[model samples]
Target: VVPGINEIYDPRTKTWSEGPERYFPTYPALFLTQGGEIFYTGSNAGYGPADEGREPGLWDLESNTFTEVGGLRDADQLETSASLLLPPAQEQRFMVLGGGGVGESEESTERTAIIDLTEENPRYRDGPPLPQGTRYLSSVILPDDTVFTSGGSEDYRGRGDSDILKAQFYDPATNSFRPAADPTVGRNYHSEALLLPDGRVATFGSDPLFGDADNTRMGEFEKRIEVYTPPYLHDGREERRPVLGEGPERAAPGETVTFATGQPGRIAEARLMRPSAVTHTTDVEQRSLQLEVRRGAGGVSFTLPEDPSLVPPGWYMLFVSDEEGTPSEATWIQIGEGLAKD
Candidate 1:
């Protein structure tokens, strides 16, 4: 597979096939929308020219129609920015955060933009800004419906000790950010962040351009990883995370699967989280959906949504959260394909 080409691999058929030929910049921030179209958030790697292929829009592969979404502030500075599909997949909202100017121009933006696809003319609106201009910022979705964003440099590649150690938790419901514990290591270019099964976030990899303020010394690749325990998992909330005792290995869409939980009374919500396959700043498969939870005599039960587009057929991490918003260590479950999906 090369640039501007998409190769689709089907595990069931054990074969590879060519997909539609479309031109997209490297590492384009693409998300799977419910209507079966791909949404390009205009966030991409530091390769393309600032004038082309950096507009946020819906790429309808079926008809090859590109509907552009406007209202991005620092449109020219989108390279190395971060974008994500907001939690509770049903919301159909997206957010794009800090980015740098194209091809190492030493320009960066703290601008953040959000769009709600459910709107008739869905265009991006300005969200809160970061503390400073940043690039190569890493973000991950927490099970508690908050997005944890951390570690980026103000310059193109931490060329002048410009790495920002700050981190923040962005709440979707409140549309605000609260400060989080600063990371010990400064992560810049090539850094990554992903959620662990135990509700902790593990961050890895950083390759700065220079080791010192002066441009003479070469930089080193950071191999040490840092695991962050979110606030929900602390303050005696660790023991309160709901535990799934018994359940089936697989469940069909819309089928009710019951499970015995350690603390059923405290159980409030269930989520189907797709384990992410992340590249430095992009994970196209990261998604989470709410499951219909029912309390009964034997135990708690969850019903997967009937819509195949909403709950795609695949293996997912099942997490049950308590009233305190603490989630259990994930249990793997396979969601069977529905008849509606191809």
Candidate 2:
């Protein structure tokens, strides 16, 4: 709870200040504003109306304080499934798009909402609905402030489907959203999207869509990592090719690769893709690694442990992320006969 000096609180002094509240308990995501405040959305883990069970809404962070933001009235609403913090223009703003919540009844929703931070308390105004229906998807923020969201699930006309591998982008400048290149590999649950240093979006994770009768999903999880680069991009005068670096061909068995945007203030925890074989070595193994790469560092590297069991001969994908665990570029590499030095 304490980042630096550990001291007990004294109600008598009316100070010692309160502790920083941990908002993310179950896949909760947040973003940092240009004004140095944290913006987040929380979901109910079947706790109560206060937690919403499935209800999703916004939360604010300023001066180490936590305040709730826009939320759905229904306890089962999942409207704010995914979001990204847009760099301040006229005022601070957030692009919240494509999340599934309770529609008419207990059914899922496909609405999009944008939160304008310039306001006193911030306002959530509904945006143009998604081109198609979607739910349980993820998004990323580009240097130009474009938000790209990927595949999700839900039956359209009544046919139950999950692998909705479509993609879309939202631009705040115009207060509108447009479509981006779609991914070849589609996923549902447990999947994530990351923004790469080279201006492309990398996505990894698994599909929650179960197959007919008995096949099940992709062996409990996905080790496949794919990167998506914009077909066209420009800096000022000349065209700029996407320049994300390639990871190790072999990852020294258990080593990991990290990604970063080279921006300082925009730093947070990094996420990685694990091979399905990676089991719980201990209680801690159940969770993802929380490594914060130095801002403006321009790049992040994950040195493989010299241990043999940690990394064996196998191919794996590595992904890095910010504090909210929104993934960046996902580089694919193989781990073969090689030492840490090699």
How does each model score on TM-score? Answer: 0.95, 0.53
Give lDDT tens digits, candidate 2, residues 189-237: 5666665544476788754434432434323455688887653342331
- Off by more than 4 A, model 2: 1-25, 33-37, 43-67, 70-75, 88-90, 101-106, 155-159, 213-220, 233-342
Q: Using lDDT as the measure, which candidate wins?
A: 1
Instruction: Give the Cα lDDT of each candidate.
Output: 0.87, 0.47
TM-score of candidate 2 on Cα atoms, chains taken together: 0.53
Show the colliding residue pairs in model 1.
Answer: none
How many clashes (backbone N, Cα, C below 3 Å) per candidate? 0, 13
> Across residues 151-176, which tens digit of lDDT does each residue of candidate 1 receive?
99999788889999999998899998
**Worst ten-residue run, lDDT, model 1?**
333-342
Error of 2 at 103 (Å): 14
lDDT for residue 196 in candidate 2, whole number 0-100: 55
